[model samples]
Target: MAACAYCGTTILFGGIKDDDLRFCNDECFENGYALVIARSVSDNVVKREANKIYNGACPKCQGIGPVDVHVSHRVYSVLLYSSWSSIPNICCRSCGLKSQASNALFSLFCGWWGFPYGLIMTPIQIVRNIFGMARPPEEFAPSEKLENLVRIDLATQYIEEKSMPPPVNDV
Candidate 1:
């Protein structure tokens, strides 16, 4: 059993191959190729610049930072329909805490009305929110996810550039 080089899914059937790399599908091939090119363009300089930008003032409160990313879950249910989502924020500690508190309350109030999933997910979401609130934000460093977000943003731009055709030398 071989695994796809791009998404790591086990290949149960014939898949596309590029030299030594195998992909599960065309979408994975395209995405993986773009990632390779993006990695080539995203050198240490790009990472450092991204780090500096990420450590700037928090987007929500404009407070002095090295902000961290906070994630909170919310669940809503009515009868047979239940939906849940995770809300993520990059902000200072105070802002993150505030958001978490509000989201926790929202989940507590509106998350237990559905048939089965609401009953199951409500407590889970509340517990997750509680755990998230317990983790204190870093004062002098960006969260790991924050750094990854910055890197991804830069990588996307680089991928776009690599995919574009070269300018024609029109004299």
Candidate 2:
């Protein structure tokens, strides 16, 4: 059995092959190609596409120039419970800053209730947010980080949309 190149699913029968890469289905082929294309494109093309996406409507506030930013926090309960999670905010810098502030505050208050891990992770999360806020994204251009994020996002969306089953109409 051959493993699929993109998703690593087992291939029990004949599968797709492009050169040495094999895929389980057409959807996988398309998804894999999407990622390959994103990675193989020149930096100039990538930057242009990234800037176009950044100029589009922001997913959160429907504004413009939204850059991808990740904000996470930690929460601890009593003695034995602790959790670390991120609040996903892919929006403008202002919105991301607000999200970072609130999540950091939440971590500061709630993340110190557990055991040793709570004490350790709380400060780390807070410091991370502080440093992240210190470096705001470019106002008129997308950074290299933002361009890579856009590429991944585009490939992910392509995979998601292609992998969904077609709707069946019941007459």
Candidate 3:
């Protein structure tokens, strides 16, 4: 008899699926084993579809643009210059707009990079960068208000970028 992987309940070995593996019982098999695998697969599909929707839309107009837009990832060196960062941006063949692929990614980067209020600093940094100011130092502290500001800026940028007309020349 094999023990349940999760609860360790003793059970007779049940037959396998295609992989020839054994399980303790139907409950343990379904809840402990199969559900985990299935959840991963479902998550992957959802992520792919979200990416498809994000990349397929026109970066400038947010409308469905030309079908030939290419999605690519690029690595950039941040302030430390030793560690490299990977950023996903989209290049449009129709509108010629090149910008970050997803707002969620921008949010994640801020959250992950030790910025307490990254959601706010990110767009401020972007706007400051656009206006020729040095981005706030990475170690700069952020507040809850800053986080809200960053989220608002990101939303506005998204809306503006999506509503603008596509480029005239077909790239």
Please, what's the RMSD in Å of model 1? 6.1
**Candidate 1 displacement at residue 55 in angstroms:** 3.0
lDDT tens digits, residues 27-81, model 3?
5555445333333233333333334534466655676633222322222223423
Off by over 4 Å in 1: 1-43, 161-171
Candidate number of the best lDDT: 1
Error of 3 at 62 (Å): 2.0
**In order, how many clashes per candidate?**
0, 0, 2
- TM-score: which candidate is best? 1
Each model's TM-score?
0.68, 0.61, 0.21
Better of 1 and 3 by TM-score: 1
Candidate 2 displacement at residue 79 in angstroms? 4.0
Which regions of candidate 2 fall more than 4 Å away from where they truly are?
1-38, 41-45, 64-78, 86-88, 161-171
Off by over 4 Å in 3: 1-56, 66-80, 90-171
Give the 10-residue window scoring lowest on summed lDDT in candidate 2.
162-171
TM-score of 2: 0.61
Clashing pairs in 2: none
| Clash pairs for candidate 1 | none
Candidate 2 or 1, higher lDDT:
1
